[model samples]
Target: MKKFLLVFPFLSLFFYAGAQNKNLTMQDAMLNARTTLAPENLSQIQFVYGTEQYVYAKRSGNDVTWLTGDFKNKEEKNLLTLVELNQKLKAAGRTELKAMPVVQFNQGADWILNIQGEKVAYNPAKGSFTTLIDAATAAKGNVEQSKAGYTAYLDHFNLFVANVADAKQVTQDGSSDIVYASSVHRDEFGIAKGTFWSNSGKVLAFYRMDQSMVADYPIIDWTSIPAKNVNIKYPMAGQKSHHVTVGVYNAVTGTVVYLKTGEPAEQYLTNIAWSPDDKYIYIAVLNRGQNHMKLDQYDAVSGNFVKTLFEEKDEKYVEPLVPMLFLKNDPSKFIWQSNRDGWNHLYLYDVKGKLLKQLTKGAWEVLEVKGFDQKGDNLFYVSTEESPITRNLYVLNVKAAKSRRLTSGFAVHTTQVSTSGQTVIDNYSTPEDPRTILLSEVASGHSKTLLQAKNPLADYNTKASEIFTIKSAGGDPLYCSLYKPVGYDAGKKYPVVVYWYGGSHAQLILNSWNAGAGDYWFRYMAEQGYVVFVMDTHGSDNRGKAFEQSMFRRVGDVQMQDMMTGVDYLKALPYVDADRMGLFGWSFGGFNTVDFMLNHPGVFKAAVAGGPVINWNLYEVMYTERYMDTPQENPEGFAATDLTQKIGNLKGKLLLIHGMQDPVVLQQNTVSLVKSAVDKGVQVDYMIYPGHEHNVLGKDRAHLYQKVTDYFMQNLK
Candidate 1:
């Protein structure tokens, strides 16, 4: 691998950077982002990316039906009857159904079944029933089914493969030091799944994490009648980290082969992609230093290294979270996504490690791939090509490398493509439109509305949010948004609360419906006559690698610089009260929230930081090292970013909140921060959620948010 440098346009030297349509701002972002109820659907739902065609269950008043054609020539098909599912569930001792049960089909929708509860299957034609597995409320490990009718799951520390008839233990070791069939690297590097089935379903590839050498941190469970101590393998920065390997299991042979993605054994193996032929596996192997990465190909059969397709290195870091996609017809040629040129785009490469061509290039990043056509002639993708704030679909000819904008309207569109690439299922919303799920025809660019979700908060009086652009310390433009009081009086200054999470890989603001997501508390606070300001600034996501890495070797510095620039702008506004400004954040935003209260003392009279990382030294290796390097490598940087050093500078009613059982940020961070504050004679307020983790969620979330609002009102007001 060779090292290289690409100067980011718009002056990498300087950078800076919200809004809500009737949507949620960071203050209330996604405060109601979750849905507790499931929508009724047909046997299955499928969408064609970049097109207005899709297959889904359509409901018309009292009539519910399924369609299997384009938007224009849609054909209704009777897949199953209510009588059939009720009969099947009744035989299985389930209560008689109300309407029709939500049934899921196989990948190809060849069969319909109830994946939940008893896992019952129905043969609509024959009116027969098949119970795949017994009713299970939940299991110790996650249970996932393969297209080939095999179920793979984790049984505590071991991995298990099973079917309706029989089961087999894939891993035998039960020691807590080792884990099989589990998400590793604290779920970073986009590694969310452990078990991956081959294309033809002959093998199972799973992650084996050995944390025997890592440190065991004790988490207290205080809710029990008698407190319980839970020990977890927590690898801190520069510490002896856990090792991971990929093991492939052949179901027919009952043989296992581990990939030889050799390393210091502590390196990160991410973005596992299987070749179309199922003969090879590709891994984006990142070194422990995190500055260098190689897209390595390995033989699935022998676990032998086939070749290093390419490598990427950067002075700050090279994060490879996406895997390569092999062409459907041409296995020898594959498409790889990279940000080497300062923007994420697509590049075509051959199996021989030759760069065939650059498919897409520009200042925009491809947000997601909606999949290719059945023939692989066209590729559909959602991108920031339209505007960084919005997501729209585009279709590209794989061979010609030419792309056409599929979506024209100004809105955020999360698209899905059909097998033939002729249909697109567009789930989009605007500030004016709460949600509009459409079926778009790829060739004609015509769309038919599938569902227009009415405003969920129509009855509630929510003040519309406004977006603004502010310049950062680096002279780059930053987007921000705020919600004013329901009945605003410009003659009077309103207390303003600035909430943000300016960390890597997460962009808080967007141009979607409901301004992407909002906080209900923000609306409540607005109704009570306060302004809520939130910004997605530099050192965060979407812009480019350089924009995010501006804080390299320093965690909370640049983020705050940009944030304060925005705050200063807000302070100048006639309606925003400068003296009553407050700040709030969670996780990375939490880390910086404390950083701001202490580093920039008096900026916020009151503040709340939940689940914060007190010091980089205490954070996990992969993430911390990527941004801050090892504590030993950058002692001064660590010293500058650590909250312990700035505790004495704290000059506000600072409230530090934490989940006692937080594995990511850990309760130790708040404990350490509080102790340092005491040692330095600094006043600090604190709270702990007995059984919560990194985030205070569920019912407790409302309580936590209310507490934050109360703290700011008591102190800032």
Candidate 2:
């Protein structure tokens, strides 16, 4: 590894020599960030469905006005106001809305506005509205709507289908142990929503999870009068997992058929897709070991296994998160994302699983697949080709095997392509610029700025921050960010706090606004006369597969090595106080905090770990096994990382915080560690948030941060 660090040349030095204004309060940093302190943007912004026109909400006080602009003419007008919308709804004999409902363009010029529990289709130009579905009466949990006028949802563990006039129950034998139309596998493998609607929208496929064989884990709700215990089915590592299967429901005939996914019954069915003709359903079937995956096709109507389209196997693990993206003009062809060559890129495949060619190739990962043009020849996507810290837009010509970058700038961009593929709405941000939305022509790449948000922290006396890179032990460039103390002096030493989420699927340092430190808490720490540092180690996201796979068997080993490298770098600096260093992280990061405190004893003066995973054996089956494997299979690996066994190694002041109702990383983890600490005669500080799950959100977040800040202040400051 290189001994010298390489600072990014393009990054503007945030150290302002001039006198600044007010400092950030905890409320302004934590509670009011997304509200009053947030950067302004085109609210509810998107291209009108199937049209080149785009619309966004503009709020002024109690009223919200929607503005629509044409892509060709660049003319924007007030499409409708809250009063006008309410007047139209009242005229149509529906209940009036006090505030503007979240609107989406569905059927041509009509607005599908979600008002309370009903999806109302309103046409402001025609002064008419139609109630599509009343969610309160008909649909509830995991609701999914289709263009074919069918709504599928789960009510009390049972699956139901609702039409215009009536609702039909799809499953009758659903109970607490038998769930229907719900996301299964603990939401791993990129499963966000429960139901999958076919292209024709006539068929709905959902998951049926039978966790009766699994044991129930109790979480005490302290908010209750007498502290009620809520029993949840949590499958720990090496334990008996829940059995899951897919159920296909026919809306036209009101029939249900279970997919004949003959298996060990404990496998994972992820990345579900449907044929355009709605005849076949494709699922990526992964074994419980999570090393082998088979992309299989099944007949939708018959519920019979058709064929295995393809298979992927890895020595460590093969994670398929994105579903097949079939071409719009050609249903027989699709795009698949894989990291087979050690980098996440796109590949072209026929329906028969024939590899046509690799469409994209490079070191950077393809972040998202936007969409294809009207001809399906050009594909739009977001990638880290320019830099891992920045996300930019790129358009690939499938036929020519060529690609070009559409959006420019050293910032993170999120884009929405118009249906015609002629234009794109690009939303991006940088440290100096809060946010900027651009309307760009896909063909020529000509762009026009729609909104350039004013800096929200203009009035605040924020300190200096910089995003740079330090070499890892293996010669890889690890990204790091540093926030200096307010009124920093080079002659005096200042206490330092290191923060990071050095885990899979997360990147803490970025090129966006506030350098990807979302809350003002970092600035608040800087205000308290302490330097803050964050680093995205090898295990973090957006890097290639090899960088993450390094943590396959041993989770915290590589990340700790890189983190210590960062610490060494900081100690060399004259302004950083090596003896007064501290650490902070939550969730996986919380795990890191404890790992560093124990494994590398006396390295940190103080640390705060929130919702930490104390024992890998106690963590959930899906996530823990993916990285650490089963405890029974790799007992030594689990034993090495388990913090409960190493409580005696802890040297400095450590504060452990947990949510009493945290289901993800259960409170049992902390209890187990505390029990071990007691046995070892070690003293540690602990705090708990009652009735909170996984994270302490809302107003409670400020309290949690305050507790963390106070602990660090009392110990390290």
Tens digit of lDDT per residue, candidate 1, span 1-717? 111222223122211112223533333433444441111223246642333335565666654554555665655455445565567668767666666555554234234445456566665445556665555512547676666667777776788787767778888985799888878888888889888888877788888999999999998878776998989998999899999999998877878999998878989989998988889998999998988999999999999999998899998898887889988789899998888999899999999889999999998898788778878898988899877778899999998999999886777887767667777777776555666777787898888776777555554556446655677766677877677876688799999888899999888767654455544566677766789887887888999878888889988889888877877787778998888888999999999898888878887778899899888888898899999899999999989988888788888788999998898997888899888989888888998887899888776787787788789878777
Local accuracy of candidate 2 as per-residue lDDT tens digits, 1-717: 345566667767684524468888999999888888898989989888778788899988888999988656767999788887777767888778778888886345677877887877876667777777885844478888888889998887788888888889999989989988888899899898779999888899999999999999998877688988889999999999999999999999988898999979999999999988899999999999999999999999999999999999999999999999998878889899999999899999999999999999999999999888888889999999999999998999987778999988888998888988998999998777789999888878788889988777777888547888888988899988889998889999999999988899999988888888878899899999999999998789999999999999899999899988998999888999899999999999999989989999999999999999999999999999999899989989999988998999999999999988898998888888899999999999999998789999999999999999999899997
TM-score for every candidate vs. truth?
0.90, 0.98
Give residue 76's lDDT in candidate 1 (0 to 100). Answer: 49
Model 1 scores a TM of: 0.90
Candidate 2 clashes between residue pairs 3 or more apart in a chain or in different chains: none
Q: Which predicted model would earn the best lDDT?
A: 2
Clash count list over all predictions: 26, 0
Q: How big is the positional error of residue 476 in model 1, measured in Å on the Cα after superposition?
A: 1.1
- When summed lDDT is taken over every stretch of 10 residues in candidate 1, the lowest stretch is 10-19
C-alpha RMSD in Å of predicted model 2 compared with the true structure = 1.6
Candidate 1, which segments miss by more than 4 Å at Cα?
Answer: 1-70, 73-81, 87-100, 120-140, 163-165
